[model samples]
Target: MNSDWQIELRALRYFICVAEEKSFTRAAGRLRIAQPALSRQIKKLEEDLRVQLFIRNSRGAELTEAGEILLRRAYLIFNQVQQTHHDVTIHSRHLGGVVSVGMPPTPGEFIAPRLLERSKERYPDIELRFVEGFSGELERKLANNEIGVAVMHDPAPRDDIRISKLLVEHLCLVGRSGTLAKPEYSLAEAGSYPLVMPSRPNFLRILIDGHAERLDIPLNIVTRSDGIGHTKSLVKYGHGFTILTYGAVISEVQQGVLQAVPICNPEILWTLCVAMRTDQGRKRTLAVIEELIQEVVQELVAEGIWK
Candidate 1:
């Protein structure tokens, strides 16, 4: 238990290089230093931290659990330092850096392009990374810092996440164009149609089931899928009707390949939110991205694009 010790940033970087390359020779080549010197630096870093960072074998240098933890923290530290340097050296409107955001398929399709476009217009030098996933996958990425921000629908409450509700979106029935005789369906009437929807515990499935239970209606779900793309495709070929928000089907609807009609007699609504990990310090770039997301959502809602 070494309580008082100092580790240099250079040593951490050397360790990271070795861990990433997984070979002292390769790491030395990449760092443009002698292998012996890189080995010495990693050894010193381990001594200072009082833990074995790597397990060297014939294969290569493999990181121990301690090394893995240090690598993650080192990446954050270096990113923060880089961001600080950029913030201090660049103009306010010309902020340049990288941002990673995660979103579910529905909102992902809409927001990613718009966010990238707006980010490019305002911060020409900034790079945007967008990750598309389901609610569960995006939640895990956000918690692990794999993504800086996330947009989700019907997100479960978590103590470590701070969520901001961007809008309340109504659920609608998605079907192939000209397949349905009308543009609206009540909850009771929707029960009679063969429905293609996500399985239980998914946000949409949960909402629909809750309403069905409260209203004493039986849903005839013939097929189940977790992917938005598959659901849309199934509905497009007349496999079965699926439930979704207008934002989820805008592209297909406009192309006349699919038709989206609001469900009523008791409209079902799900809250769309942007969330971030509360355990970490907020970054300037993340703040800007969050604002951009909210702005884009508001603009789309106002223009009837995300209704």
Candidate 2:
């Protein structure tokens, strides 16, 4: 293996252009350079990496397996470079911009207010926008660059997104006060109750269903709702119980409108994560806001506001 080598950013950009155009001639035209020069740069890049990047024939160039990997990494490198430039530019000016953060309904209820207050006090010029949705919806928005950051629960793995574990939260069985009649419920006991739950593909629903399946217990789902308010309403009105994080029903639990019992006997746990697009150019304001989010969550956990 060739370990001693250096590749230039210009070469990476040229290679990416060729990979996208799939023809050295076309890429050279787009780059406003001679085809021979473009080809030489690509060849040098291949030599430095000691791998065949592209296969050329009558139909121009096609990326080899190595080329595909390099292309992905090159995009990340360019994005990081662009992000650094943006950060430097912003640092020269006042730290002020619209930083959008997405969160699921449950956590948002507790996190949004404190985050907004802290951000306002610290960075008055910066505008903080909150987008509320389920984890799947938030993840989609984050990936599409519609939002700069997302706090998600048990997010699935994605190549384009970077995930950082924030905390582990236990799932609980929620019902109207004095209805559960127990301090805790086992997996099978919880599954036996008529449940009001979110539809399929919901992060919480997926976690619950997977646990039930593994335990060979069938969930008696009586109703399906995607809305957090609607689900809580149903449970409040004596429709059925639902499985959710304790944070989701904290207000109701405090008001004595609902009760939450920890799921014991192989307790169900899900990781809360902060997710951001790996290819997105992060702004300085956004970075500070992300840090603020982490700080707020940590404080909430310490205060027992988010359990």
Candidate 3:
């Protein structure tokens, strides 16, 4: 590649017009540029590339092979840039613009409970929408602007969105604070447990299943519901144990209702973050967002949830 290949779209367009018109006088008329300046820019473009892009004859100018090739690729690049601006403009203009929010299956799982609560409290008037999906789908929706924000596992955020670190969490093996002696737990050695985790086919469930397979143990679900309260209540009542994130059980942990045993083998460390729009908006928009995020982090920090 040429070192000076960082040419602008306008330059490519001027070249294309000159090539198509094949006449300095006529191309200038088509582009509304004075013939002399149009000639100078195209000349600079060719010089930067170290290639002659056109040949001048008695009648006009026509593109050489190099010019034709570059023109084709430039056309595609400019068209994509054009479409991106168009889409972003449309998103901000629509009334009651839809901001689809992605939810993790088990409500209040991970750092989700307080995050959701803070969002509602801070932006009570701002419309919020929710759709349940895994990290992968949520990333896609964020990229397409279908989902304005997502709460999920790390390493899935897109290039277009900004993320704020909230907590470092993991699935800890826990039972009602008192039952660590008899255990009767078989998979503890291989990182498996008869945990009341999200059901199969869900993202977290798939991750747990993979670990269990490697440990060569079966994960028997004593509680198969995707309700956060229900799963925590099950473990609190000593019906069974569950592997949940710090945010999922932080309150209970602090209250001594559910004590945690950090997973030793095949440990999982996950970071929770909040996703937000990158656009610089009026102070009103950012004020709400700032409070919402600050609340989640401060709440977790005050409770000593994240390490």
lDDT tens digits by residue: candidate 3, 1-307: 4775786878987886787678889989989989899989988888788899888999788778987777666655553554455456644632222234575654334345675566666555455556676665676655554455666667344556777775666666767877654423334542444567767655666766777788776766766856667888988987787876655676787898887766656676666665655642232343354456557666657876554
Q: Report the error of model 3 at residue 274, Å.
A: 2.8
Considering TM-score, which of the candidate structures 2 and 3 is the better prediction for this target?
2
Among all candidates shown, the one with the greatest lDDT: 2
> What TM-score do all the candidates reach, one by one?
0.71, 0.71, 0.49
Local distance difference test, each candidate: 0.84, 0.85, 0.64
For residue 212, give model 3's deviation from the true position in Å: 3.2
Give me the runs in candidate 1 sitting further than 4 Å from their true place: 1-94
Cα misplacement distance, residue 147 of candidate 2 (Å): 0.6
- At residue 178, what lDDT does model 3 achieve? 74
Give lDDT tens digits, candidate 2, residues 241-283: 9998898889999999998999987799989988887765356
By lDDT, the better pick of 1 and 3 is 1
Clashes of 3: 0
